[model samples]
Target chain A: MLDYKLLHALATVVECDGFERAGDVLGLSQSAVSQRIKSLEVRLGQPVLIRHPHLAPTPAGQRLLTHYQQVQLLERDLRGSLPTLDDQAPRLRIAINADSLVTWWAEAVATICQEEGLLLDLVIEDQDVGLKRLRDGDVAACLCATPQPIAGARSVALGEMHYHPLATPTYIERYFPEGPCKASFQSAPAIVFGPHDQLQHRFLAQCGYHGHFPYHLCPSSEGFVRLAAAGIGYGMMPQLQVGELMASGQLASVAPGHFLAVPLYWHFWRHSGQLIQRLTQHLSRVMT
Target chain B: MLDYKLLHALATVVECDGFERAGDVLGLSQSAVSQRIKSLEVRLGQPVLIRHPHLAPTPAGQRLLTHYQQVQLLERDLRGSLPTLDDQAPRLRIAINADSLVTWWAEAVATICQEEGLLLDLVIEDQDVGLKRLRDGDVAACLCATPQPIAGARSVALGEMHYHPLATPTYIERYFPEGPCKASFQSAPAIVFGPHDQLQHRFLAQCGYHGHFPYHLCPSSEGFVRLAAAGIGYGMMPQLQVGELMASGQLASVAPGHFLAVPLYWHFWRHSGQLIQRLTQHLSRVMT
Candidate 1:
């Protein structure tokens, strides 16, 4: 059987990003933390970490960390059933897209979290890649655009997030004086969420403009909307998030008929405890 | 002189996270993109990237990237002077902490961005580490807690962000019925931003607590406030961000007459062009 104490040391080292910080977190000496890692490596008969350029876990280390997290979940389940074991509130580590977190997620999950005495460790990732957090065992559950679940996990459709190509009226007048067309799109600046965000590119393609365009990359969801509302750039604004701005006449759709509806899914391990099950149900009921 | 075309290929590959996407962005075939990378490596007489585990630049490659970014900044200055050269707006990549981004940054820079026809590429990083982005040449400027400037850079104090240990009324009633003390803090949950965030820890230490305490990690600035207001956990919240919540009776300080003031600094290259100069003037004027 594998030693959980050693696994915990590995997890803490990776989490803290160095042996010194891991020691601070674990209340162990720096050399002691290093010894624990070495012991784990010897027991496994393989090196678990790459320590040269930066402290990154090898594939073997990642698998062990994942296993440790799963075991932690099971232990939390046991603790839930036995109240005398520990009175500490349970923590649910979840990977959620920034759009959802900014829009409906907090309001939807707030009640359940409060009532259940649960704490949250939220990882904000792009919808396109949020599922990777689940696959890598960095999170217990994830809300992502992908519908397919990895092995041992189940995915439930939460609903769709509709995005429209939106810009301020003055911005439209300035950039698209002749109305949005191929030539206009080539010159007009767009607001992209990040390098991995393809919403703008896809929206431009839908408008029959498949050409290089200049864009401002704002990683924050709130910042993205602020940049658009400030007339800095046009971008794909989610209907759920931009309702207030749209209603205030601060933003208008550049493309009248075209919209992108991305379906969101909640992915969680099938055997996850009551908390995951409850959250999944809550998300589906509220979002759908 | 180094070939700028090769450097552009390198930057795009790093930005896109793969050669295939970089090719699409660059309007080149996948093999052609790969060939460009090879040519650059041959010219340098060393491997620029480690492609196995993930595509990451070597230290030498990083220096080249930094040089390329600096050159681009200089070129943008030249284009600003010669308007007919290119009508494209200049892009300024900046690293900013989430608290500033959520509280004052968007409003402060919105007018300048709109008027100057400048585009922002904002990277959200913790204030403690934001200077590293500036040092690595990933950003033109950065807002961080560090007052010390690197070589060729100037650091100016923007203002102070005061953080108070806050919690919802009901949460305080449940967790700290006898008022906040070391024993209560040991049992009561706290909301932390992430591993690197030390605000909560500092606040706890100030409150005369040094033992281990449980915390829920929430990375989003807006979400962190929401979590605290929802009665999930107590946290160190910025006064700028929680004034409305406090006014509404949703949040209140757990510890009276205690707060952490993190001084904000704006760090930028001393030799940057007109746009940076204007921004620096605007920030110093408004923030102070």
Candidate 2:
């Protein structure tokens, strides 16, 4: 059996990103926090953290952290059954893609969270990489493009998020005067969400343009759409996010028929508590 | 003088987060990219990269990268005068806080971007830590709470962002039936943006509450507002973001008169090109 107090100190250190901040949160001195970490390392006979350039957990440290988080979830379940436990609400950390959060995710989970008296810690990542958060045990659940679940985890298919290569009417008239073609695509600028986002690259490939093209990288979902609408660049806009804009003629598809349908999946621990299970079921129903 | 080609390789490696991807983007073989990095390091007589765990630049590498990016900016300015230079639009990377991005940022720079035929790479970061991006050579400019600029950079005041502790009427009725007091604040849930966000803690301190309180950690600016309006938790809502909601009677101030005024500043290199200077002037005029 492991000492939960020591594990908690490790978790807090990672969560706070420093021993000093962890001490502030845990109501202990910085040296005391350091002492606890040292004691845990002494017990385990290995270092759990890489303390130089940046504070990150080692592989062994990650496994222990994941175990601690899972135990915390089970304890929350136990607290639910026993009304004598403190009435503090439990927080569920989820790694979700930005497009989902900007469109359907908040509304889908809002009711359940409010009813269950649950709190959330939402970490936004690109769909292509969100699964890593689940795999690393950094989050209880995640929404990603990948359907495969890691060990001790389950994945459920959510519906596809259709993306259209969209731009303002003025932008289209200026850049693609003869309509979208290989030549036009090579010249016209495009908006990419970030380095991790491959939607535009894939969409362009589907349009038969594999050559290098210029692009603006905007990390914010709202800002990406706004840039496209302001004639800064055309981009692959998610259907759920741009439906109203498309209807209002604010944005028009640069490629009329060609679209990318990215399939989303919900991944969570197989042995998660009832709240997570319920939330998973609810998302599977409404998301599709 | 350092070879721009080698510096370009270094920048591409960091940008892509891997050598293979950087090779693909640079149209070089993986070994060629590796050779370029090695040659650059040999010339410098020190290691530029820390390859294990993660790919990050050493201090010397960061200095070289910053110098390379500044030269790129100057070359872009030179291209404007030369006109015969390939007509690729210059891309300016800026680090901005989510609140500013969500509210005032895009609109402030949209016209300038469109007119200048410039593209943007906007990196979203918390205001408290955004200046680090600028200092680390990751961004050409940054919007942050810090008033002082780093060496070779300039800082301009951009006015204050007022944050009010806001909650729905029903949430207030349930959590603080009488009125907001230390006891209510102790038990009631709060919405914090992330670990770096201290607005709520500062606001609570001002309200005469210095005890530990439960909070939901939300990293997205739009989602944070949604969570607050959904009645998940009361949070320090930015005045620019919640004005419409507050006026429509959806969100109300919990403490009535109390608010947090976080002063914002724009930090950029002192020797930037005309485009950056124009942007600085534009932001100063409108953001205030």
Candidate 3:
């Protein structure tokens, strides 16, 4: 049988970036932490981490970490059946992108997590990176953009999030009075979510404007909408978010009938309990 | 002089994560991209990147990438000085946190970027992380929590962001009817921005609750506030944002006399021009 303390020590060191800090967290001496990792390495017959530049797990260490997390989760479930553990509400950890957190997620789960007396530990990152956290067992489930499933995980399509290129009427009048063309699109300022955001680029690419054009990055999803509505710059906004602005004429669709749809998927561990089931059911109801 | 094309290739490879994708970006064969990197590495006499896990630059490569980015920015500025380039307004890139972006930044710069016909590129991250972007020359300036000045950069204090431990009256009654105590605090669900968020922890520590208690992660600052206001969980929120809700009794300070104050600073490149200076002045005026 593998010693869980060694596995915990390894994962903590990788997360903390070094043995010294991990020792502080684990309440052990730095040398003690090192010894534990060494013991684990001896048993596994593989070096589990890279020591230079930064402390990161090797593929073998990653596999062990994943196994350790799964076992811990299962143990929590097992504890739930004991009368003494009944008072401790099971906490559910999830990874999700920032946009979803603001748009609909908080409102969706506000009741469930509260009413059920369940705790939630959310890890927020970009959609792609969020899945990496899930695969590494940092989170039990993830709402990701891609549909690809990891080992021992199941994925469900959450439907496409449709994005429309939109701008204020005044913005359109100032920049694209003659309607969007190569020159107009090139010269006009645009709004982007972040550096990794490719929606604006993809939209412009479809318009045959592939050059690096100027843009204003507003990282807040709601703030992006507000900026676009205030006539700062044109941006791609989800259809659900832009509906009111479109009706009010605060935002006009730049490309009518053309939309970029990003399909999102919900990925979760196959052997989940009441908490994950409830979360999945709630997300399916609200997201769809 | 160093060939900028190779520097660009190196930076692109790091950003794109592989030679194959970097080749696709530069419209070169994968082998050719690999050869260019190898040549550059030989000339530098140091390996610029780590080959495993993911393609990330070593410290040496990061230095080179930073230098290349600075050179590119300088060239863009130089290009703008020509009479023929006068019509093309200079684009100013900045890094800021999401809280500032949504709170006041988008509104504050909306007029300047639009009326001045200047483009603004805003990169958002946590305050400390944003400063890293400024140091790496990804942005011209950054608003950071730390007042520490980077090499060749000037920094000014921007005032403090005060946070109060808050919850809805109904929530307080349900979770801590008597008042916030160690037991009540541990049992109550808390809301947090992300893993890096420690405002809630500090507040709880002040209240004598230091153990690993339950928390619900709401990544968006606004969403965090909304969840707290809706009785989902108590959270630390800025005083400016909670005023109206507090007045209406929709939210109340859990620990009335306690608050966490985070001091902010504006940091900019020492050798900045009209755009950066104007932005610095504007933020100084508004943030204070």
Instruction: Find the 10 residues in a row with the least total lDDT in model 3 chain B.
Output: B82-91
**lDDT of each residue in B1-288, candidate 3, tens digit only:** 998888988987975667886887688999999988988899999998899765678878878976875665565567657646545555566777667766656677777777567676666667666787787666778887888899999999988888898998988888888788878887888887764566887888788777766777666777777778768899888876668898988899877899999887889988776567777787778767
Better of 2 and 3 by lDDT: 2
| Cα-lDDT of candidate 1 | 0.84
**iRMS values for every prediction:** 2.1, 1.8, 3.4
| All DockQ scores | 0.57, 0.61, 0.53
- C-alpha positional error of residue B155 in candidate 2 after TM-score superposition, expressed in Å: 0.7
lDDT of 3 by residue, A1-288 (tens): 889999999977975567986897688999999999999999999898877555688878888977876776666667767657655565567887666666666677878877777677666666777788788776789987889999888898877778899998888888887776887888788988765577888999888788767677666787788788778889999877668878988889776777898887899988865567777888788777
**What is the model-wide C-alpha lDDT for candidate 2?**
0.86
lDDT of 1 by residue, B89-153 (tens): 77788999988878788678877977877788888888756787788777889999989999999
TM-scores of chain B alone in all candidate structures, in the order given: 0.95, 0.94, 0.80
Error of 1 at B184 (Å): 3.3
TM-score of chain B of 1: 0.95
Which ranges in model 1 have alpha carbons more than 4 Å from their true place? Answer: A52-54, A81-90, A285-288, B52-54
